[model samples]
Target: MEKKQLFRNSVFILFFLCAAFTVSAQVRVSDFRYIDNIEGYWTMKTKLGLYAEKWKRVDDHTWKGRTMRLQNGDSSKVDDMRLFLEGDGIYFTIAAVRDSVGEPIRFKLRVLKAVGFVAENLQSPYPQKITYRWKDTKHMDAHFEGKDGRVSREIIIQYTRQ
Candidate 1:
């Protein structure tokens, strides 16, 4: 009789857990899709210098990356980056590589196409945009553009697999 009661209690607990999971499963996970497409070590070079970007999947719907400027034999962190999907599309946030003292700048991947994705943060100084355009499997270009007051700025860095 004791054995039968223990078995029934176990079955009841299992059923409750399954029901809980089913209810929570209706919630969505992050949707960082294009990220998986660009998961690898990437390096960019331009007239100014060289930069490096690295990406890796954190989970099904989240990816994290780091960027740095490299010169001679030394490298410095450009930014710490994160991409994740909350509702419809992916969102991006970036912070200083060494210290995240301030609020992170935020952006949304509002534009995603076959070629690439663009993330932009619109603020008073002028919206800053980062674009990753794919040329082919082994080549791509990462561009950054912004405008403050009357000054306009743009940087295009050509990238290849490293």
Candidate 2:
């Protein structure tokens, strides 16, 4: 029947459009390194803690990132960390398991308002209420506070594009 054929055609077209949209949303990971020629591993000592690791571009807009602490030198899992560009800015998320509390912690870094980067919720007591600030690519200055209105820690991190 004509109606049946029309319905089938509509479904096919819809499927094609959905597939195209999905592909477009997936950014290639390699494009990240092109930003500042930032490739390889680097480390930084922060007042909150010490972080060391490598951040390598895997494909357009996506990167393979990992971090470890200076105290024990236990390396973080690469699969747990990802760096990518969203829209005009770059962002990174590091998912770590807290050793002291045995809960999952996430450190999120996002570029905020013009030429500024915000490292929020590095190690947050609550999910939404966390630290934030503006920063340069090489150095970061921010403060983290707890719910009790006390300064948890202040961090100054220096980064090198390795």
Best candidate per lDDT, number? 1
- Candidates' TM-scores? 0.68, 0.40
lDDT (Cα, tens digit) per residue for candidate 2, span 1-162: 999999999999999999878744443333344434334555576564556656566777677756566555554443355656666545555465343567445444432333333434535553322222324455332233344335444434455433
lDDT of 1 at 154: 86
Name the candidate that leads on TM-score: 1
lDDT of 2 at 21: 83
State each candidate's clash count. 1, 12
- lDDT of candidate 1? 0.73
Cα lDDT tens digits for candidate 1, 44-86: 7755568888889998878888988988878888878887876
Report the Cα RMSD per candidate.
Answer: 15.6, 12.6
Error of 2 at 82 (Å): 1.5
- In candidate 2, stretches whose alpha carbon ends up further than 4 angstroms from where it belongs are 1-37, 44-51, 70-80, 85-90, 97-116, 119-151, 159-162
Worst 10 residues of 2 by lDDT: 126-135
* Candidate 1 least-lDDT 10 residues: 23-32
